[model samples]
Target: MEQFSTMFLSFIDTWGYVAVAVLMGLENACIPIPSELILGFAGYLISAGRMEFFHATVAGMIGGMVGSIVTYYVGSHGGRPFIDRYGKYFFMKKSHVDTAQRWFDKYGVKAVFFSRILPVVRTFISLPAGFARVNMKKFIIYTFLGSLPWTMFILYIGWLLGDNWKSMLAVGHEASLIVATLIVLICLFYFIRYKRNKKRL
Candidate 1:
């Protein structure tokens, strides 16, 4: 973890805001790049007078939007077919896709907006939205709105931590686990209820 942090810090230090945008973009693209490290270090730099706060946040947002747009298109175009054909390899099953579809159908706007704030869910929410074929305009608008606060929040946490920004990485990791577990539990509860109702009928 320290190695990844050092690597991202070096890149951001060398490339400035460009690094922030690119790193955040890759992260939102569902790549394994950690936004906590990227924004946290940027916040630390802002404290050091190395980077401007507004500029860094904007760059992060732009990168995040660009990456998410790319993934959205990937899902809109070929995500469902790919998942249907070869999802098992990636640990994504058809039932997972169907669940995403149901969520989007029932709460498309809220799902897109709030999912952007959730840790693990935020990362892949765009793909599901794409699968649902949500309106392009609405998708872009909600995505941008959702991501802006989150970008600011993460950057602020990093800024507050300053030299100790690395500490937040552990917090981010744990938060992700918690969110993932809650989602799984909720899904299981619904599945069991659906089964019981079906048997009653």
Candidate 2:
């Protein structure tokens, strides 16, 4: 954990917007880089008069699009077998993949937009959307729309808490754990509900 914080802080300090962009993009690629940390730190930077919130948000959005594009293509061309094989490498389970597909089927393009606001679910959502061959234009549009607001909201949190930047590493670690737990619980609940629905059918 100390090593991670050290590395992350070094990256943020040295690369600034570039670091934020790359981190956010990597997050989309299922690399476990939390958007919350990046946005929050960026917000803290803004409050410290180090960066503008608009620039930080835009950087995050662009990074997200690039990362999701990679996942989308992987889904579009890689097929189910490919996903099954590599899913674990990216911390994705087959059940999660299926759930994303179910949501995509049920909600169409809108799922792409809403999923961006979710935590762990967002990481795998684009893959199913790509697999389902959602309209490329619509997919990009919705993804941007959904992710942009989230990016801003998180950044705002950091901005509001700028005085605590020195201790952000610890705070971020705890916040991340909490958010991850919540996301897992949400997914579990939905998974059980879906299974019940399927059984009833």
Candidate 3:
């Protein structure tokens, strides 16, 4: 993990905020880059006085918005036909999409904010939001607001850990697993209840 940390740290150190923005944008665009690593390393740079905390954080947030906007437009343009043709390849399940849409329906704007921080949910939640034709201004606002805490959190870990930022791999993974498991359990509970309710009808 140190190897990966070093790599991303190099990018941030060498290219400064540009690296943070580009890589963060790619991550939010679902490009498989880990934000924990990116923001964490930037945090480490802050400790070393290699980067400023505010600048790094802002770049990350902006980049995330940029990537999310791109992804949002893709889904908005694609709609159901796009999902029908390519959903599986994107790791999207109809049940999950339905749940997202339903949640968005009930919660309105808060769903976007919450989704931005919920592990795997954050990545693909935008698709359903876009598919449901959510208001663009509200979507953008909520998405950015939701992402700020997460970015600050991971980066804060990096800042505190200094050279030991590599240690975050274990810490982050363990925390993420616990959160993800809880989310899965909650979803399963609701799913089962819905099934029973449907049967009763």
Candidate 4:
């Protein structure tokens, strides 16, 4: 842990603010960089007097927003055909994407707003929203609103936890798994009931 802290601090010393922006942006861009560590590292920097709180927060938000815009455009322009051809590399299947699209359609802007804070959902919600051709202006607005609090909260964690930041990431990952499992179970139950009702009819 001490070695990691040293290496990370070294990174901050070398790249400064741009590294924060780029890492956070890639996280949103589906590159699998965990925001927990990304923002946490920034927070640690702040606590160590190497970074400013406002600068780190703003950079994180800006980086995340930029990455989200890129994802939104990819979903909007490429559409399903692109996904059908290449999404498997990302472990995405058509039915899953279709389900997300339906949910987004039913919920509209609220889906995008909430998805920004919901674990893995935050990572891919833009795809279905883009496929549905949601308004770009509204999408950006809700995404920013959703991302702001998440950024602030996670950055706070990093600042607070300091050397123990890695542990928080583990806990977050496990929590995401639990939430995902619950969602799957709920969906499965709903599907079974719907099918049974159809048979009765």
User: Backbone clashes per model, in order?
Assistant: 0, 0, 0, 0
Model 2 local distance difference test score: 0.79
Which 10-residue span in candidate 2 carries the lowest summed lDDT?
Answer: 168-177
What TM-score would candidate 3 get against the native?
Answer: 0.73
TM-score of each: 0.76, 0.77, 0.73, 0.75
True-structure RMSD, every candidate: 9.4, 8.7, 9.0, 9.4
Q: lDDT of each model, Cα atoms only? A: 0.80, 0.79, 0.78, 0.77
What are the runs in model 2 whose C-alpha is more than 4 Å off?
165-201
- The per-residue C-alpha lDDT of model 4 at residue 60 equals 88
**Ranking, lDDT, top scorer first:** 1, 2, 3, 4
The CA root-mean-square deviation of candidate 3, after full C-alpha superposition on the true structure, stands at 9.0
Top-TM-score structure, candidate number: 2
Question: What is candidate 2's TM-score against the reference?
Answer: 0.77
For model 1, give the 10-residue run with minimal summed lDDT.
175-184
Local error of candidate 2 at residue 142 (angstroms): 0.4
Local accuracy of candidate 3 as per-residue lDDT tens digits, 1-201: 558657776887899899999989877765656788788788889999988889998999999999888777877899967876787785566666666667667777678887776655566677767777778999899898778877887788889999998787657656455544655687799999999999999
Looking at model 3, the pairs that clash are none
The local lDDT score (0 to 100) that residue 170 gets in candidate 2 is 53
TM-score, model 1 to reference: 0.76
